[model samples]
Target chain A: MAKSTIKLRTKEKGGKIQVKALITHPMETGLRKDKKTGKKIPEHYITKVVVEANGKPVLTADWSGSISKNPFLSFSYAGSKDDTVKLTWTDNTGKSDSIEKKVGEK
Target chain B: MKRRSFLKGSIAAGAAGAGLAAGILTPNMAFADDVADNPFKAKSVDEVLKMLGASGAESSDKIKIKAPEIAENGAVVPVGITSEIPGTTEIISITAKNPTPLAARYTFGEGAVPAIKSRFKMGKTTDVIAVVKAGDKYYTAKKEVKVTKGGCGG
Candidate 1:
């Protein structure tokens, strides 16, 4: 399983805090025909992604062959006390990976 | 000069001017035009959902996606996504109709962006739909970007 990790940090806000994350993957579409091989690359892409915070699920996405390689995502969340956000991804090839991060109040 | 011959000459000139105008407008129109007409041979979002077999979903307005209004090059158009929604979970996609609509899919581990940035090559102009799964439902937004003639070749 190819795993990933996210590290979240936020400035102290009286109400809510924002969080961000990044993932590592090839995200190959397998569409372009290789010049030398002269064959269409087999479809090997991330089909699903999941993100969780403090034991609660927050965001998820479905992907297609159009995504670029090594995708980078950023987002914000209402922060509370010590919270943890977890991430996981699965590809069409059935390969999956996961990682975790701790949220800190600034 | 013969009256009939003079009238005919003016008509020919008028036609040429109209033709040139059309030629110039064509390029501009192509830039703003969405590729829905030639949508990439892609699958429907519903079909992808069934294939992925996802369970949890969420919809939130906190998500925002930014890309160029008109991409000169369809080969590599940059896209960025940001979510203000709390407790981010998943991100999914589906182009109206492409060979394979599921674009780049990602999830957050710890310090992941409620957002993601990537470059996608558009065979033609089309709407890039970004669906963010938060909580237990799906929330989505889409923007149509025009893929004009690129440097590679039109």
Candidate 2:
């Protein structure tokens, strides 16, 4: 599967750079009815997420069915000289995706 | 369909008479009692996400998000985010693409740690998003969560 997209932005002097990422997937909460068959939908959800800067992991997340589709994530990292960050995620279906971003220090 | 009609019909019944109002009110009150703490409302993840303005493009890595490998209960899965980055402005939003994407939204000021933890209901299996804002930038982290039968009332 394709990895999620990570966006890094420049932070102010002594400011933290903001990083945002999004992955495309159906966060299927097996609760609603199928539009066609009118049957309850099967369950599908993501379970874990991790983030690293210049290869050093910094943030992680745990999730459930309550989350929305095509999960979106936002967080911050100490403005670093490394200029690169990595991200990874795994789902309940034994699926995983990861990506990396370059930070702009302007 | 039935549930929607039931909700509307009860509202109509409540408007009919004081007696009917009392009668209809009892069930709603009972429902509130039944789900006094069932934070789950039947909305798709997309709708919830939009409602909260939690688009990840405006998020940043200054915040840290933590979640579990597997959730035993869909109704009460725990999620956490902490900002170790400087100039942290605000931390907000949780989305699960199951039944209503936007779970919750939080706001903070500069220098605020912007760390938060909360329980959310998952309609099924899906990925979750933690969107945070630092300074003038936005960041996000995502995790996939698996829900077993024991979690939701399955």
Candidate 3:
């Protein structure tokens, strides 16, 4: 199995679930030129990210290359412990990755 | 052999038609089409807002943007947005001076909070605008973040 590109953490506090995720990606803007090659890099970035709680989507985000490399995202949702939380991201090149975890577990 | 090939072709066509219908019916598929069409490629914040059907958004104090006044490294600038408006369905972040101003757009569903924290790149000093959409109306807050170094180039 390939190593997961996403690092996710969720905590249930005060009846709310705080979710923080860090995704490893280059997020190339296509405008940058390689210092050695002198050639523009092709545009590559994550286009969409979806976060679901208990199999239902709680948040969705559309992103561009302007987002920093290895993007970090944090948000909170009203949910209880033991609920299933899943985070998935799709990039422009049709590459995608996802990770699932139970709330309050790690 | 000819009849067998003809029947296979017809089956493939039927399958494609069904897939097209399913794509149209799925909300996620429609959203994918929308993303492919506009906003991310827009060069200006105004153009992005227009594509999002949020032109002439009003300035609001209820929206708060937390970011450093000056960033030593433009490659990674931490930013956060909090919307106090009720029924806020969406939040968008824009870096005014970036080549592509529209940075990110987040949609919240039921049981979700209206606050978000993320990181973005800045080519130079720019105004970071946070737009909040609530019940058909758009509200915005702006904060200036000065970048000591640009982030776009290698």
Candidate 4:
């Protein structure tokens, strides 16, 4: 809903690019109860993470409550310095966040 | 409600692990395709495999799970998995005795490496299994991680 709280980084070297992203979310599993309220916390977590470079699909990851709060994802893809990488995530409640960056970004 | 506010409010700049934020691309803010169903509902590792229609997965040395021996935060232990087996294409991480054993899954594409690294929440000290699908068969390797719940250990 709000502007993305995701941090992104992309680097290119020797005909390859590495992309890393960290998503900030509660990732509540609904099993953990409030210490005081004694009620189950509702399940909320990023369900799917998709990455696109130069407007083409590159990677997609599916996750569940098992993922830790504020999940970190890092992987590599073939690309050059000028290629752009965009990442988006959808959660169980349908809320979403996205961010994009070009390779070689600091 | 109060806890939610504290959690959400704490997400200021650099809160997402301090990764560099580059130029924001216009109109690239679209949500992803239909979200897949959560994999945490499956009760056991066997059930998780059944969901994928995979069976007879043999233990293999080629598959390696890199996790810490002592995890201070049971909720976020960085775990890495790599499969040196040729033709390794699909990978999944599972816990042997959690409420739901399967933690995550990935399908590699052309030229992609047979490796994955992500953080997983351990309900307790358990064997975290990394399974790789090469060709038509499945192979697995596991590591035991002792999770100190509630950060009680000093």
Q: Which candidate do you rate higher for TM-score, 3 or 4?
A: 3
**Taking the tens digit of each residue's C-alpha lDDT, what string does model 1 give over B90-135?**
6655554455666655565554446665566566677777777667
Q: Which stretches of candidate 1 lie over 4 Å from their true place?
A: A1-17, A104-106, B1-65, B72-93, B102-121, B129-142, B148-154
TM-score attained by model 2: 0.42
A23-94 per-residue lDDT for model 4 (tens digits) = 889888767877888766788888788888877767677787788889998778667788888889999999
Q: What is the DockQ of candidate 2?
A: 0.07
Q: Which is the leading candidate under DockQ?
A: 3
Model 3 agreement with the true structure over B1-154: per-residue lDDT tens digits: 9998899799989987886776677769566565454788888887888888878899999999999999988989999999999999999999998999999999998999999999999999999999999998999999999999998988
Per-residue lDDT tens digits of candidate 3, residues A1-106?
Answer: 9889999999999999999999999999888999999778999999999999999999999999999999999999999997899999999999999999998666
TM-score of each: 0.54, 0.42, 0.86, 0.79
Q: What do the candidate models score in CA lDDT, each in turn?
A: 0.60, 0.59, 0.93, 0.77
- Give every prediction's interface RMSD: 5.5, 8.8, 0.6, 3.7
Give a tens-digit lDDT track for model 1, residues A45-66.
Answer: 6766676777776556556557
Best by TM-score: 3
Per-residue lDDT of B60-151 in model 4, one digit per residue for the tens? Answer: 99998889998988888999888899998788888776776877787766555677778888888889988889999989888999988832
RMSD of each: 16.2, 14.9, 10.3, 11.8
Each model's total of backbone clashes: 55, 77, 0, 0
Over B1-154, each residue of candidate 2 has an lDDT whose tens digit, in order, gives 9998899799767765665555556777655543332233426544434434444444455556677768777666667777666654555445565544545544543222357555566656677776665666666767787777333334
After superposing candidate 4 on the true structure, give the runs of residues whose Cα lies further than 4 Å from its correct spot.
Answer: A1-3, B1-39, B150-154
Off by over 4 Å in 2: A1-15, B1-154
